[model samples]
Target: MLYFSKMDGRRWEPLQHDNQSTVAADFRLRPKRRIVPCRPRSLYHKRSITMATTPRNPRSKSGNKPAVAAPTGVIPVYDSALMQERRQRILDETRRVIEENGIESLSMRELSKRANVAQRTLYNAFGSKDRLVGLVIQETYLTQLSRMKFATAPDTMEGVIERLARVCMHFGRKRNYLKAVMDLYFAPTVHRDTITMMRELSYGNSRPWLLQLEQRREISPFLSREQIEGDMTDLAFSVMRKWAIGDIGVARMADEAVRGFLVLAAGATTGEAQARALRTLALRKRRAAGPATAVEAAGMADMAGVE
Candidate 1:
């Protein structure tokens, strides 16, 4: 059933037809002035329903294509759970490669093979090796932060120092990957970019730990209230670098010395334990340096003056 309708500019003359189809009634030309009532069944029978009221192109006055609105918010298109698992797998493989064969061995192809993921997948997950390493460092920091719990205020400074020492010692003993991470952290400029990124990536994870420690007077007692922050950050970086480079021996000894200083600073607890620990540590460190024979002395003096 076809019906002929006369058009007068933007208006149309109603035509008498014998068919059930209302397609002709919906053949609108001036979209702004035209209004056609549509039923759900009409939309199902003929997909010509206009859901949006906004004109496709207000400026264009005459175009056939419909305008699309831009999407809002940061929405992930990929399967989030699967993407997370894949990302984790890549990070694990990256750490393994760095730990076993050093940072030089960390290649996209090698990581892809180890992770059983394609090169494209790795690229999609982590833009590059530096990014992946940054993520790995971030995850490591987050994992460590999760384990550390802070007290509001330790009874004595010595106890606080002892607890801090135990935490450092335990971390040093556990993480064998510290050496590799330390190497990157102290590497030259070209490699230092990754370390900088790692620091930024881990800022979120570490800030809370520092804040929690600050909430407790335990941290303030060690340094002036204002000086505490700068001192604590320096101490944290120093401890991390030391442990990473196998300088834990000095740190272990320093721990005992720190305890003594804490006692003097706190004026609480007897300084006997700290005193004994410090003496034993000092003697051991010097002895451990081996007999200071004349040959070692001359070599040390020569080397010290060379640079």
Candidate 2:
């Protein structure tokens, strides 16, 4: 059976046709609109492209997990200490070259020379310059988070502030690392997707740990957990942006950050732990003349032959 359709602008009017197949063939030959087959829902979930109307999961209303949980369960794979050291070397070098010459001028040839690793290692570790930078930033961010962990203040309010304060001070020493993070966070068009992942990892991984911060003696009892969470987030971004643009010196960046954080977090009854941590941090800053190389600051007396 064949049908003829006459188009009047956007409207189509059906007409009687003796040969349906012939009319259909003619219609196919002259397409009025392009028709494309949609990919299966499984394929869409696999790609993980987020859209406003894209139902992340058909089964889950909250869209918690995708239709399928990602392999490895959204955590880092276990690697031996030796493997971690090797990767850390690659990351440190990647940070050095990119900061020295900017991301645009970065080359594997130069990175290979500077990073003190074989060119193939760079290729194997990260597939491309973009990914190399991404991993470098990710590793640096993770390092800060790792340093924040505390046995004493597992989930206390003072403990949370103390951890945040310590991490801020630690990162404030690494000029190269700080510059690279600022670049990644601010460079939207250059590395948008990588930026998204970095932020997600930063916030997502810390949420569970943040529950410990609630109702701490150092934090305002007047503030709700929701308010504290929102304020801390904005404060972190503000400090980073200020440091990125060179508006604040390294020591002051950390100082004002911790102080400002204390002010925001301070409750009527300030804990001894909070007061003691602040004193220790301030003393460390005063003892140091200025920012030193990552190696030197680590109390590494010599970094002989390191690129």
Candidate 3:
């Protein structure tokens, strides 16, 4: 006698056994048996088979598996309003902490305590300490940049001087905090993303005005926008760095920045614009020839006004 056993529900295989095992045997050969559907022996067997064939739910209450991940390119939304509020509070506290204690003294635990948020929440929102610091610096710069109402004025060499003066005044107002931030921004070990973001912010703010100047023919058509912007940015940053490091006062920083920009612009401008740049450069040099008192320096800064 030949018998078959169910393999998976779809197929069966022949089972061989000795005569003593089953107590029966067919000595004569017979035709091969046809395959038939398997039938469960009892309700318990049927239930077991059904359970074995069914797919499992990852999020089922009876299973320990985690919930399925969101589909590709799908972002999960959370409590947006509350998260924004929390982020704002954290940023405010971060600015205060960095301003009072400097970046080197900023502790995540202390910041969390100050902001009344969990340490994990900080990491969740900003990813890392370097990122949080970058955010604070970026926010501060943007806030100051936005406050310069005169920034929207006509793009001219005078407008450029005014903008640099405004920037210097902004830095002067937040000297302690910005100095520390600038230190971190220029550090050799600073995070690449943070530095890249800082540079992009600088470039983005300047490019539009530079482009406008180019369009009006205030900037020379021979000069590429990138070259003009790059040179001006480098000069501005060098002067700002000197101010941040206490090597120069805000007045001198503004004067130097304006002078440097004018020198570069003079080379890249034509017609009346070139003449204006050279004239401004000469005036700035004459003003810087003598050592001025605090009041005089302040007056000079006021003269190179933003509006």
Candidate 4:
């Protein structure tokens, strides 16, 4: 109904299509609010921009201005439960490592990994691998200590000697533990710390047992308390040394030697000289029964018959 007219060709525009076609038909649609982009700024903050760069704690060496507490190394702090669990875990892992690879193979990182703990935890708890080895020795000593059944009760000198023998034999049976001790002994200068640590730990762990052993008058008759203490300590370490060196084999001679030492220590002359006399008599009998030429034995027998 209108006349056709020519317009300016310079003006152009694109047709707008519904955006809903791009969205899934089943999807629920909502009108979105338009958002204007802006740079974030907090208005409530009081400090000026220059004040932030100036440093609030200008007097402190750290320059934080507010100041923080410094740590003191003089006092030792420990969490008892964490320490207990960590110690036990380390010990268990150490034993396993010693059994699997050998004592020399127990590296700090390897041990930490084996124990499922961090290497720092091990260093913080034990200082070094040498100290860790020392703790392992302590664990071994504790295990052996537990097997000593006669620490409290004693009936006779023979019983005490038997108990000592049993303890020595039981310790030697644990080959890995003996190897660990030997390793501690021969470890390099840096590792020697563990040896000294073990000496202290061993002496510490034995204090109570040694006290109980001293109370037995039948075990130490002539030796004064101090003398007995020194002797017992020496004897214990001597046996440990022997065990480390693998010197005590399955021989009756070692047992007899141990028995003789116990007899001497217990002062058999005081209460039971008769036992020693009987031992001497048995020795004499064995000497008389020694193997010899038949003619020589007969000649000696005939001379004895003439006498």
Local accuracy of candidate 3 as per-residue lDDT tens digits, 198-277: 77776764566677767777767677888887777777777888888779987678667766776787898777778876
The global Cα lDDT (0 to 1) of model 4 is 0.53
lDDT values, one for every candidate:
0.51, 0.56, 0.69, 0.53
The estimated TM-scores of all candidates read 0.44, 0.46, 0.65, 0.50
Best to worst by lDDT, what's the order? 3, 2, 4, 1
lDDT of 4 by residue, 1-307 (tens): 1122245223222333476343222333233345798655665556666644655552556665764433322212466988788788888889788866677687888888889898877766676676677767777777755645443234333334444444445545566766777666665764555655555643443344445555543334555545544555455555566656667662332244344444444343233433543454455356664212232223223332220
**Top-scoring candidate (lDDT):** 3
Candidate 4, residue 279: the lDDT equals 59
Model 1: residues with Cα > 4 Å off, grouped in runs: 1-79, 101-104, 144-163, 190-230, 246-307
The digit string of per-residue lDDT tens for model 1 on 1-307 reads 4333455445443454568445555543432256798787965796767776854462323675554333422223556788778777888888777667767777899788889988977765565566677667667656764555433233333234433443444445445455555556666643445755655543332344335445553343444434433344345556667656666663453353343333333331124434533554465467764312232223323332221
Using TM-score as the measure, the top candidate is 3
lDDT of 4 at 221: 57
Off by over 4 Å in 3: 1-79, 151-154, 216-223, 286-307
The positional error of residue 240 in candidate 3, measured at the CA in angstroms, is 2.0
